[model samples]
Target: MKDSILRLKSRLIRTLKLENLLFKFLPNGIYVFNLHRIGDRHSCQFDRNIFSCGVDQFEQFLLLLKASFDVVDVATLSQILDEQQPINKRLAVITFDDGYKDCIDKAAPLLVKYQLPAAFFITTDFVGSERIPWWDEMAFLLRQSTGRVFKSLSTGQDINLQPNTIEKQIAQVIFTSKRDNNHTLVQILDDMREQFPQARAQLAQQSNSLFMNWQDIHQLKDMGMDIGSHAKTHNILARMSTEQQLHELTLSKQVLEQQLNQPIKYLAYPVGRYHCFDQHTLDNAKVAGYSLAFNNEKGKNRFISERYSINRYCFDEGDLSTLKLNCIVW
Candidate 1:
């Protein structure tokens, strides 16, 4: 019954293009949207969920965003926030999460073509390294697991994996568990590798082509894109000790700043669900020299909102109607 109503609402919004009208009435704020990968979902092997959209969908989204709101980059948004400038028009900011090679190969080109700017949050370890980030590792292992299930490392909970559906979802829950610790992270990964030995071997071979090397990132910066830290290892900061959390923030920032010759002033929390960060993480971000921080949540950012907890929604839709519905509903 409820889903049917949502579907009808979605249909009306799509058919009538109600979001355009609604956008006019909404309070002025920054509608920050994030993407992970820009490509066909079916072609991905490790984590199909990460594929945000294909080339055409992304180009059209650029059009829709440009026509509707004042599209700005994260740096520009920060400047506005710092100055406490009242928004005269509704603003939108585009971002990409993770250091996927596709950011350079696919998304950047279109962004350049549209003459738009975007900020990319990169998981430092995944850049120029063959090691798969935790989420991909979790997804690949679950897919290769013969039982379609794996025991949660942090809590003895059993995680059910259903392909093309909940595989990555369950992994998100497992990887982002609040009780997660370094020892537990290592234990679960080692357990998965032992349980699914062949899977580890296979994923290792495919890892080389997965993320951007430093050269690719350098070129991306030269293309006029902004780069920010997504943490050194993409761990849930709230789950870590203060020292560990601080280390994650500082190390990632230092490395990025040194490599890119730019101040790393922003952070996009890894597995940035609501529970993924805490007060301590927020404090540590300031200490680490980040002027602004963002998380993966659904909502827009008002100018007076917390700078350390800016909200961003995933905008990985293939259809314009679906995209409109998502942004409206979120």
Candidate 2:
């Protein structure tokens, strides 16, 4: 009973951020970590939730990773698993998702400084395009809405935009509206734009260079980083038809290979939750010609069965130490 109380207290402390003792419970295996955006968290008006770390804090996290774990590349990790070796404690692999600009502008320089290898998964359609992600656009619209009550055109629901609750409002919008693709969402954004024209005008002035283009992707590849597919579009695979999943998987790989002149052996499922991918997605990944795939599930990769569902601990929003602890797997 005393042991249970102690464990409960530990969890309470970690959950409430009174202390960051979460890493104390880690298991022995490859600790694959994922990051999305890597710039100043409050710097963007879009999705602050996606910000991993600022430049200096990111460097501190890198130092922490170096001190705490044996960092390796994805290919090395695959080989280690293939050889049927014993799982090593804190065997780490760093990865970036969503092809965000900060992965190139901010994270890469520091990665070079530390001489660490990482994989980057790119959403092919948005690279070199003026398109902002669905979440970002949703945040922008929600935050930009002047009315106290947001009448959602897509869902035909009224969302209360309480004072100083833009974060909550964005969350509500995304929860109700998220889907496999933005086909229906395009009209929703347009409807929101009609309701809020000033925000739409303001959005046009923001840089379209938010995502890394083909040239910048080439530049990162030149830096000796591994490139893989996030998908053709950043859509949830399980929410898609089998044909759609196949198209997203195969076409993204084909495009990456064509552009980079190398075999694209890795894939990180779009959204990467258990519900985000089905068995169909896995079969299609094999048919798409990927050797391995990653998902942002919190667990240890202790065996070869996890090749398709490679688990990763991820950090998006928090202080450096907290983010570091959050990135450690159990």
In the range 1-330, model 2's lDDT, one tens digit per residue, is 864765565566677765445565556668788899887767687877778777877788788778777899988887887787788577888999999888888999999999998999999998988898878887886777746577876567777776477787787777666542443666666777777677888988887668988888998999989999999989778877999999999999999999999999999997788878989999999999998999987655766585789988776664755454444423
Choose the strongest candidate by TM-score: 2
Stretches > 4 Å off in candidate 1: 1-26, 146-183, 205-207, 317-322
| Segments in model 2 whose C-alpha atoms lie over 4 Å from true places | 1-10, 13-25, 153-157, 179-191, 205-207, 320-330
lDDT of 1 at 30: 84
Task: Please give each candidate's TM-score.
Answer: 0.85, 0.87
lDDT of 1 by residue, 1-330 (tens): 865876787677778868767655666778888888888876566676677889888888899889878888888998998888888778888988888988999999988998899999988888887777665676677777645566766666776666565655554755554346545566667877786778888876763568999999999899888899999988677878999999999999999999999898999998788778999998999999999999888776666468898888787556566555666765
